[model samples]
Target chain A: MKILFPIILYLVVSLLLLAPCALCQDEVSGCVNCHSELDDGDIEAPTELFKNDIHNQAALGCVGCHGGDPTSDDEDLAMSEATGFIGVPDPTDIPKICSKCHSDPVFMKSFDPGLAIDQYAKYMTSIHGIRNSAGDTKVAQCASCHRAHDIRKANDPKSSTYAFNLPGTCAACHANNVYMAGYDIATDQHTDYERSVHGIALLEKRDIGAPACNDCHGNHGAVPPEVGSIDKVCGLCHANNMTNFDQSTHNEYFDALEMPACETCHSNHYVDSPSTDILDGETSVCAQCHNSDESPEGLEAADGMRKSIDSLNTSLTVVKEKLDESDRKGLFVTNALFTWQEARQKEFAAKTAVHTFDLGKVTGVTAEGLELASQADVAADDLLAGYVFRRAGLAVSVFFLGLLALLLWLKARQIDARQQSL
Target chain B: MIDRRSFLDWLLGGTVFAGLAAILYPAARYLEPQEIPEAAISSLKVGTIEDFPLDSGTIFKFGRKPGLLIHDADGKFRAFHATCTHLSCVVQYRKDMGAIYCACHNGRFDINGKNISGPPPRPLEEFDVHLKGNEVYVSLRG
Candidate 1:
């Protein structure tokens, strides 16, 4: 009985040690069990918030990120330095901690084969990364946008880094007057972008293809597009307009002045659709730079281009109306209508040619349109003339037929009277 | 004997030829390169020492192309063709960056005209710089 009592005490002690290990093997570790029972808000908050986290949903436990032993139920044993328990990482060390698994291509591929592993490398090149490396803890780190405990995929609509939500997410830090006061950045970019053409397309129209904050400024390696590269950024959409601008003499002139290419005229945040008003008169973008007193020849060229475009548009309208009138009169003005359509196409070509900023090119295209419009007008006039000739010919034929009928009636009456007298 | 139709055709053709020559002659003359008397000077004097402040760069015309002259912070002068090696764009001295900067592509070059960063593939072509009694002279190197 004494030997049995000693054996029973040994068995109870061994089972107490083995019970936590058995619980750790069941997926809910000793760390979660102890933390769930804690009354501290700091300890309980992460446990509760982590329930819906992407990492938690993927079955990655707290020890995967926090770096502690999950099997031990004793607080000292689990949180000991010997077990590699690094508590909350500092702001400067956060990026490196995230990159441990993110930068590993093999690890990232296990979850998503196509996921890029260069985010850490690109983050090192960003202004935030550069400043952070220089020991500025105020700069944005991994947890700034991708919330630490509850990060979602960038494609998820609820994600702070999602395309549609990025503007508001950026504005959280950027628009805060007290937060951005130390940095010399203008906080109006978010407000300006919301009203711009790109902003309207993305926000109001819900166009997924329209660009947001990360489109012009890159995602991980976010930086202001350099003065020389502004055209290249805008050219991703306005390719043909950029091609025309790049090939013009203005490209060399602007480059000589060290000017931002596309932003100099169209602006960066508030780029509106271009119109003929940008080429001429008091409100002209050209007139803003070139006046008759300063650049007489340049002013003359701009004026000539505007006049040519206006003339071509007027001629097209007049010819189209005349062709429509002939069609309404039951005249087959198909050939005239075809010529008028060609004129309209030429007018569009002339407007695109104005980007060359060359009067000769604009006038050359406008001249072709003018010639086609005149030809169409002539065809419509001929159709109307032919209609009038046919009407006159029909009236004359009717008058001659009436005369013949009268003469025949008189002859018949004379023959009847002669028969009665006999 | 020439017929009347042939005589009229010759007259019309000659008139058209005269009209075309009248229009093309002015255009050809307009396109022709004009002689600049100032470009004849081979060793052009850019400016005096006082005109170029310490740690400053000035662009001067070397015949038709632009030439860049930099008076570095240490009071040493260097000269090179202003054109960028990548796209022939005019490069300027950025006091903030303390390097020769080509705004066209964000290309940079060291004081000695070595291509350092960005898209520039080759060094800027160096020019012979001579200082004679505070007068800076730049000329194409032989």
Candidate 2:
């Protein structure tokens, strides 16, 4: 009996020593069991919330985050401070809590090879992080946007930081006048964005190609786009427009006057679709800055550009209508249509050249368009004239054929009368 | 003496012959292809060295097809058929990209006539360039 007792006691002690390590490898842990069975709402809420968390899906238990004896059923042993049990981290410490695994390159690679580990580093440079580090608890923490227990990948549609959802996530704080009052920032950015062309494209049309909040401000290191860099931010999508603007004479002028390039006329948050109306007239963008009394040459150039574009557009429309008429009359109008297409391309080129802010360049392209339009018009007119000539020739040929038939009949009658007289 | 029946038979035969000749003459003329005068020179003179700016390309007519003449940044003249090998869309020299680009399908080719990107399945057809006394001439490759 004594020998058996000693062997059994040694086995029990060894199993007890190795129990926590084994539980860590298992799918379930004692921490979840205790917390789930607790009647207190505070303790039970975390267990329920943790069930849907990404960590939970990865088989990470409460012990993975809180640090405790996950193998122990005893409350005293499970919550013991010696086992590194940190019940709840402070708001300021939440970023560090998330960054523990996120910042470790080796650890993060095991989860996602392509996922960047620079979020924590970038977050440090953000206004929120700077303020949070300064002991301001009101500012956004990692949990505020990502949600503490149920964090998801940014690409996930349900994620708060998804491209389509980011604007709303940011507006939650930014749009609230009370929240922004302390920061002395405009709270109507969201309202203004909802009405802008980009916002309508994203929110109303549901176009994934459209820009959202983070597309310009950046997500991790969010900041208002600087005046000097705003053109580049917009250029990410409007490459051709940006290229044209960069090469324009206004580039140097805007830089010298410390004016934002695109926003000077287009506005910042409420950029509308461009129209030719912005090129001339009393309400023209140029007239807003340059009046005939002050800048006669600039006004004349603007007027000339507007008139040239208008003339090309009018000529193109007239030629297209004529071609369509000829086509409807069963005439071969393919050649005329091809010429019209060339004119249309020239007109588009002329519009693009307007960004050059050079009247000669605009007029040069418009001249080509006008010439093409005239050629197409002449081609259609020729086809219609050919149709008229064909009808007249057919009528003349029918009259001559009738006359020939009558003459043959008369000759036959003469021969028959001669035979009768014989 | 010529009888009336014999005279009538001769007149009917002549009328049929005239009608047949009138129809056949027009038909023959319509079927015949119109002759266009061909230029005697196999090679086309594009321009002088002063006419073509350095590091730029100019499109000129080579018989029926469009030819591209490029004066590369190194001051060497190179010529290629402007039509893309994929869909025969004319390619333009993009100074920004430093490559020949077809706006049709976004096909691109290097200055050396190498197909680089997009839908172009073959390099641009290169032409032989002849330089004489500051004048540039281009001919189809043998």
Alpha-carbon lDDT of model 1: 0.78
lDDT of 1 by residue, B58-98 (tens): 98766546779999999998999888886566788878878
**DockQ for each numbered candidate:** 0.01, 0.06
True contacts kept of 2: 0.00
> Among these predicted structures, which one has the highest TM-score?
2
Docking quality class, candidate 1: incorrect
- Across B90-109, the per-residue lDDT of candidate 2 in tens digits comes to 77898899999876446789
True contacts kept of each: 0.00, 0.00
Model 1: per-residue Cα lDDT over A1-422, one tens digit each: 98899899999999998875565344344677787779998887777777767776656677766777777767887887788888887788888988998899889888777878998899999998998878888888888988887788898888888878888888888878888898999888888888887788677866555678888888889899998888888766555456778999998988898888888877787766555667776567776578778787887887888899889888888877877787788776766766776676677667767768888989999999999999999998898887787676556545545544554465556568768989
TM-score of chain A of each: 0.70, 0.73
**What are the runs in model 2 whose C-alpha is more than 4 Å off?**
A1-89, A313-349, A371-422, B1-142
True lDDT of residue A73, candidate 1: 68
Worst 10 residues of 1 chain A by lDDT: A20-29
